[model samples]
Target: MRRLKSVVTSAVLAFGALAATAGTPAQAATEVRYVALGDSYASGVGAGHYDSASGDCKRSQLGYPALWAGVHDEYQLTDVSCSGATMADVRANQLSALSTDTDAVTLTVGGNDAQFSSVVQACLTKDDAYCKTATDWMSYYATHQMADELAALYRDIKARAPHAEIAVLGYPQALSATGTCPVIDLGSAKRGYMNDFADALAEGTKAAADKESVTFIDVRDAFQGHGACGSDPWINNLSSGTEVFHPTLAGYIAGYYGELDGAWS
Candidate 1:
């Protein structure tokens, strides 16, 4: 990514110099005033290569937003998505990145609102029965309560960037539908619970997207053969207390970039 950034920078500089020499107006390109807003998934928590300037946001070059922005020179990227952000957090801190001039927006939220990280941790540590019960309750709550919050948030995002092409990205299931992996500490039942939770969140998000009349990017099949328990898992089974059970770099590329590429293509 660093090398790619450098190359892009050089190309931009060269292009500018040539345009200057020709006395031609530098490419009057239609800028993609892109603002990325959401939670840890959008912030690239587990992908590493953190942008220290973002402090605890944990933004990484490997993140889908960054990868997309890096390739699209016309994009004036303002990515305020942060690690541990909920819908409320986005309304508070990230939404300010949007405005009337914003031409494109990509969002991946609702996971933190569902307390997804905490649920995963609990499922890993708690007894099977307790884990299942807790996850089931959370899933129900997220599907019911978080739906309103997500709908409102999406409305606000659209109001803020009315002209932008908005895409609400869905969360990929952390675990495969069946079986257990040695790397993931949870039992088979708990693993299934986690998958259910992901489904619940996805359903709520899709509904919210529909309510707001925005594009809903369902990335379930994108990660179909690469869940955390799969032979080539894209999600991290565990982290060194950073962003546990989150998507790894490959996960973001396969689940996010792969699906979103057409949005800008």
Candidate 2:
């Protein structure tokens, strides 16, 4: 009777050990293959820290893509976003990262193609009159040319990452259309033009996204009070070369990624 009792106890213990070993977390998280693509905003140029190996691409670990990927272990990210990437540049340099297995993609572009940054630079280097001409041209380009350009790019991305859900993120409002702050105080005329430029760009990008059946995430409202002229600023100014008009770390975390989190399905 004693020997039998001992044998039963040992068997019970062994079974419990096995069950614990194979317990609750039955399997690891399903791996989601994610690819980050597009220009500086996607690359996190202004967010400060960078992956030096990315070279001029300046892929920031704090960028919206990295932030989103970091929160969920399921996501495996390949960030290929680069600074100064035009639509053509993306097709040439970045699209190769995409494949049928790519589950998620986020892109921010078209501002470079429209020469929006150059307009800002003009206001800083030259005068509001020069900026006004540039802004007018940029607005026209955004309305007339950018939509079709973006549509073509979207189609190309869809073709490459056939299974991936792509979201094209639009830029934030860089300055409030009203008031003056020494930080970025472009006169009200230039500020108004910049605001119009943002509006035109958003319309074009959104139209392209709708036409292509991808999602377009507008960041304007998300960054409403954080523009240069606002109480708090999320965008960097002539403070640096590459980071000009780019988002700060806080902006990417709470603004860009914040809006994206809600849209992510």
Best by lDDT: 2
Look at candidate 1 and tell me the lDDT of residue 26.
28
Report lDDT per candidate: 0.78, 0.79
> What TM-score against the true fold does each predicted structure earn?
0.86, 0.85
lDDT tens readout by residue for model 2, 54-167:
998998877888777665547777788998899999999999999998889899989889987678777767777788788888888887789999999999999999999899
TM-score of 1: 0.86
Report the Cα RMSD per candidate. Answer: 6.0, 13.1
lDDT of 1 by residue, 127-229 (tens): 8887888789888977788888898998898899989999989888888655456654556777778888888999989888888889999888878867776
lDDT of 1 at 63: 79
* Residue pairs with backbone atoms closer than 3 Å in model 1 (clashes): none
**Residue 22: error of model 2 in Å?**
28
In model 2, what lDDT does residue 265 have? Answer: 40
